[model samples]
Target: MSMLNEWQDYLPDFLDGLVVTLQLTGVSLLLGLPLGLGLALAMTARRPAIRWPATLLVEVGRGAPALVVLYFVYYGLPQLSLTWSSFACAAIALAFTTSAYTADIFRAGISSIPVGHREACQALGLSHAKELRLVVLPQAIRVVIPPLVGFCILLYQGTSLAFAVSVPELLSRAYSQASITYQFTATLTLAGLVYGAISLAAVALMRARWPRRTPTITAGATRPPEPPTRTHPSWETTSERRER
Candidate 1:
């Protein structure tokens, strides 16, 4: 009963924190996904100038730990006279990290297109942009969706890192409550439960396979009779002429 009561108090605050966490995730993805696609395109370009810079950015983003990046945005930027609110800083840092990682995923999707398809597009006299917009991207989008959803789940969990920068997300709320009530175990446990529940739900939903419909024949169903073929005048038999 005591634990239940503790959860009851924590639930409201934690729910509010969850909202912030979701918002941060949405903002990060909104900014990052398009940027990631652009980077992927640049990375695949034939020109070294275009590809090298994008490659460098992805390497740095993927090479560095997210916490370090978050710290850089929150603390280091102020030295350059660039200051943002904690939430903004967290969003920017996470977005950069997301773009870097997703760039590879996007590149993989793009590369999965068959060489024959591009050659066909070229033979059709289609411009490079048209080839991508009409033929390549449509297929690539489908391929990338499953992995993108997986990444989004990871990013949702990653939003917890924002708490380190005092962004008051779910984990931050849990820690704050723990500090005030000194119920570290209870608060932290509830927080973990909440995170686990959401993550598990997302995973379950993504893994669900919708039943596909197939043609079925009923007991009394029968195929319709074929139409009779008329004989051609030049090929009609003498017996048919006699009957006429």
Candidate 2:
């Protein structure tokens, strides 16, 4: 069969795999985001005991490759008597990586909050938790959202790594089909196209939804419209200038 025709035939299986891929992405994000926020808060805590351990976890997670983490969860954990399903293993590993990376993002967002705001909260006799819940976090959430969304896109693409653990995601399905048809080129090409199409569509939608805000220049915004050229100053008219 022609490659295009073959692609059409294989599309159904690929779509099934895509569903699994989305599920994995959603699960990882669901589990990771709150943990990431907690890590961010801990890393920013005044207590050294709290901050140190969370910092170490963030470092190790960020430093390790996702494949290694996946392998550790899927393979090493079994020996340690913590066996989990392949899907669960993949989700946990990916979620760990997600939380680690996102912790820094959350930290940056939280740090972006002005010190004056914190001081104002303190002056109002707000507890630390209340201040974060009411004032800091609300503002930080807005700052973090765009970056968080971008990271989510990265996480979605990274889900293909589950193929190593045999979780049967999009890439795994493509490889399975390629092995059977011996049409590696055609099968993989279709998979790449599928991934690219989804990613590009997401990017286009993100741009449409959150278009960059260009500064709007009104008539007096730049230089006060040159103060109307002062043809006849209110305090000194043309006749007054002649008299002077």
Candidate 3:
């Protein structure tokens, strides 16, 4: 009963923090996904000049920890005369991390396409841009959807790291509440349960929307033979005379 009352008192603060967390996740994904797609495309460019730099960026983004990136954006950038609010800094840092990690996922989806599709596009005289727009991206995006959803869940959880920079997100709110009431276990446990609940719901939604697989032929099942072709009259006459 005391716990119920305590939760009622804490609910408003937690809801406010959740709003901020959702905003951060939405903004980061909106900005980062397009950047990640561009980087994925660049990495696949035929020119070494375009590919190398993009590859380097992706590698660094994946290699560096998200917390380090957040700190760098919030603390390190001010040294260079670039300054922003804590919220802005957190959004920027999270977006950078999202782009770096999602780029690989996008790249894998793009690459999984059969080479024959691109070849057919080329044979049809389509430009590279047209080929990707008309033939490639449509297919790749379908492959990427599930993994992208999973990544967004991770990024949402990662928003907790922004508490270090005083962003007032979910974890920060829970921490503040615990610090004041000295009910660390109950408050933090509630915060954790909130995060887990949302994550599980997202995963369930993703599974529901996931593409269904088509059935494939089993081993030992032979394909039907090709039909016989009819010989032309001209070829038949020439061959008959030569035989005579």
Instruction: Pick the winner on lDDT between candidates 2 and 3.
Output: 2
> Model 2: how far is 37 from its true place, Å?
0.6
lDDT ranking of the models: 2, 1, 3
lDDT for model 2 comes to: 0.83
Better of 1 and 2 by lDDT: 2
lDDT tens digits, residues 1-244, model 3? 7887888899899989999999999999998999999999999999999999999998888777788888999889999999999999999988988888788888877876677778889999999999999988987787677667767887888888889999998999999999999999889988988887898898788778774453232353243211111111111245433432
Give candidate 2 regions above 4 Å deviation: 214-244
TM-score of each: 0.84, 0.86, 0.86
Superposed on all Cα atoms, the candidates' RMSDs to the truth, in angstroms, are 20.0, 16.1, 17.6
Question: For every model in order, what is the number of clashing pairs?
Answer: 0, 0, 0
Model 1 scores a TM of 0.84
C-alpha lDDT score of every prediction, in listed order: 0.81, 0.83, 0.81
lDDT of 1 by residue, 1-244 (tens): 8999999989999999999999999999999999999998999898999999999998888777788999999999999999999999999998998898788778877877766778889999999999999987887776666567667777888899999999999999999999999999999999989887887887678667422232232344242212111211222246633442
